[model samples]
Structure formats: structure tokens, C-alpha cells
Target: MDVVEFLSQRIAEDEAAARNLLNDRSVSESGKWYERRVLLECEAKKRLIGIVESARQAALAAMVRHPEGDTPWIPEAIEWTTLSLNALALPYVDHPDFERRWLGT
Candidate 1:
């Protein structure tokens, strides 16, 4: 698939994972502190999605502006998509604040 299509699919997958993580009752019921932290993480994921969407728009605009020319915008789009995926995965992986707040460390 093309870069744009690949990035779009990645973004969709990340969004779904974020939604599932946020809605997980086991995580939510960990503790009061954990619940609050997960809520914050959910908010962070939402913000990341906004940022990714903005980047996607910019990339599309760039592509349109240079339709028959060099495709330099693909790199930017991929970078943004990667960053967004990383942001979405942060809560599940490692982060001091996430550990302290979500895991009650």
C-alpha cells in the first residue's frame, strides 16, 4: 500500500488500542490513583490523536501542492504517524509518571 494508506491504517489501529486501554475495567479498577492516572493517559492519547490528525492534514496538503513533483511529504507523514503511535503506546510501556500514577509505584 501507499505511504498515506499505511499511515492511515496505523493511526486507526493506534486509536483503537488507545480506546481499548482507556476502557479496560481491570486497569480502571486497579486503584483510585491508577484510575486517575489512566484517565490522564486517555486524555493524552486524545491529544496525540489531534496532533496526528493535524499532521495528516498538513501532509495531504503538501502532497496536493506537489502532486506531480517529488513526494517529500511522505517522510513527514510517516514521522508524525510514528510519533503518534509511540505516544499511544507510552502508557502501556514505560514512563515514570505513568508507573507512579497508574501502577501506584
Candidate 2:
């Protein structure tokens, strides 16, 4: 799927995983450290989604403003930002919708 869809799925998974961690019986034995870490990861994913969405919006505006493709740098910037975002998806390499290009594999 597209980046937005993929990131959304990942964010949901992270939220679910965090919930499960909180519900686990071993939490008392493990302390709150792990739970906090998981929550942080979920938050980080949310932030990444926001940033990527903004980048996408900027790219769309740039395209609309330069329909003739006169500004080549805009596309290059988009490509670089996309690749950077894709790299963040490496942790989800096994996901069914994960694209191999994300890993350059």
C-alpha cells in the first residue's frame, strides 16, 4: 500500500502492542520501564506519520504550483524525503504490505 496506509497500520499495531504490554501479568515483575518504552515508540510513530503527511502536502502544493515540472528540485526533495521515511519502516520489513524498495533490497 501507500506510505500513509502502511504507517497507519504500523501505528495501530504499536498502540495494540502497548496495550497488551500493560495488560501482561509480568508487568509487576518487569516494572513500568518496558511499558513506557513501548508507549514512546507508539508516540514516535505518530510523530513520524504527522511529519510525512506534512511532507506529502507540501509536495502536492509544489506539484500544483509547478504543473509544468519546471522546478526539478521539488521532485528531488520529495524523493529524498520519501526514501528517508521508508528507512524508518525497516522495523516492519516483514509486514505483508512492506515494499522491498524501502530496504533497497
Candidate 3:
């Protein structure tokens, strides 16, 4: 497969692994272990975001290099990047400080 397709597959695999780790029951059974797992998951998610962003940038660069091509993968790259960003934001969704800062009265 081409570079964009390869990158997409890699991102999918990484996301699946992260989800598996997050859902593992062993990590949930102990308070300290759960906290550590959460931190590790957060770090994994951050790294995945960086990977997706880099892939998107590479895809954009490829499109620039081949402006006349179909460039069909751009939309997928953008969607994945946006999904990752949204996921990264989810842990903060219930934070009081975040709510106060962004949804102030």
C-alpha cells in the first residue's frame, strides 16, 4: 500500500492497542494500579496524537508534492487527527477548572 494507507493502518493499530490497555480488567482491580494505568494510558494517547499529527503533516506534504493527484486520503487524515484531539480532551471534560475557564458564567 501507499504511504498514506500505511500510516492510517498504523494509527488504527495503535488506537486498538491503547483501547485494549485501557479496558484491561487487571488494571482496574487496584486503586494504585488503576491510577498508574490511567497515567500510562494518558501518555500513550499523547504519543498517538503526536504520531497522527505527524502522519497528517506528511500526508499534506505528499499532497503538496502531487497537487494534481486525487488526494483522497487527506480527509481521512484530518478526521483521524480530529478524533485523536477530541479523545485527548475527554479526560479533562469533567475538570472543574476547565469548566470554569471555558464555560464561565
Candidate 4:
């Protein structure tokens, strides 16, 4: 398979993993465990995975409708992805690169 299909399958697998971690009911004291750094990362990954799935669906729909080339939906998806990334990192406001990369402040 080409790179896009490979990447798409990988994303689906990762999304499944993230969702399973988030939805797991077997973990006792979920409140305490969820706050751990790794679990926090898993939460963020779950949120981003939704965005990735949506973008992939949009791209597939666009390709079906107009197979000539990439659709205009891509740029919109990219913008949403950027916003999601920034929101995910909001707690890291004090980072040195935060101002330059995000706010231009």
C-alpha cells in the first residue's frame, strides 16, 4: 500500500488504543490515575484522534466527489488541527517556545 493508506490504518489503530484507554472501566481510582502524566497524554490523544478521523473522512469524501486532485477541505481541516493542538497545550503557557509558535507574543 501507498503511504496515505498506511498512515490512515496506523491512525485508526492508534485512535482505537487511545479510546480504549480512556473508556476503560476496569481501572480503579480513575480520578487519581487519570491525572498521571501518561494518562493525561492519552486524554489529549483521544481528543486529537477525533479530529484526525474527521479529516480523513472529509478527504475521502472529497476524493470521491472530485478525483482530479486534493480538495479545499484540507486547509480547513489543518486549521482545526492547529486550533486543537493549541488548546491541548494551553496548560503549557509558560514554555519558552509557546509565545513564538502560538501567540506571536
Per-model TM values vs. the true structure: 0.47, 0.81, 0.50, 0.38
- TM-score winner between 1 and 4, please give it: 1
Misplaced by over 4 Å in model 2 are 29-31
lDDT (10s digit) by residue, model 2, range 5-98: 7877887888787788788877774655777787888788778778876886798798899899887777776877788678778888888889
TM-score of 3: 0.50
In candidate 1, the residue pairs with backbone N, CA or C atoms under 3 Å apart (3 or more residues apart, or in different chains) clash, namely: none
RMSD of 3: 11.0
Q: Please provide, for model 4 over 39-81, each residue's C-alpha lDDT reduced to its tens digit, 9 standing for 90 to 100.
A: 5565556666566667756756776888776577765766665
- lDDT rank, highest first? 2, 3, 1, 4
On lDDT, the candidate that comes out on top is 2
**Model 2 residue 33 lDDT score:** 71
RMSD of model 4 against the true structure? 9.1
Ranking by TM-score: 2, 3, 1, 4
Inter-residue clash pairs, candidate 4 = none
User: What's the CA error at residue 41 for candidate 3, in Å?
Assistant: 1.1
lDDT of each: 0.56, 0.78, 0.58, 0.54
lDDT of 3 by residue, 2-94 (tens): 333433444455556656766776655465455555566656765776787798788788789879878888778866765555555444445
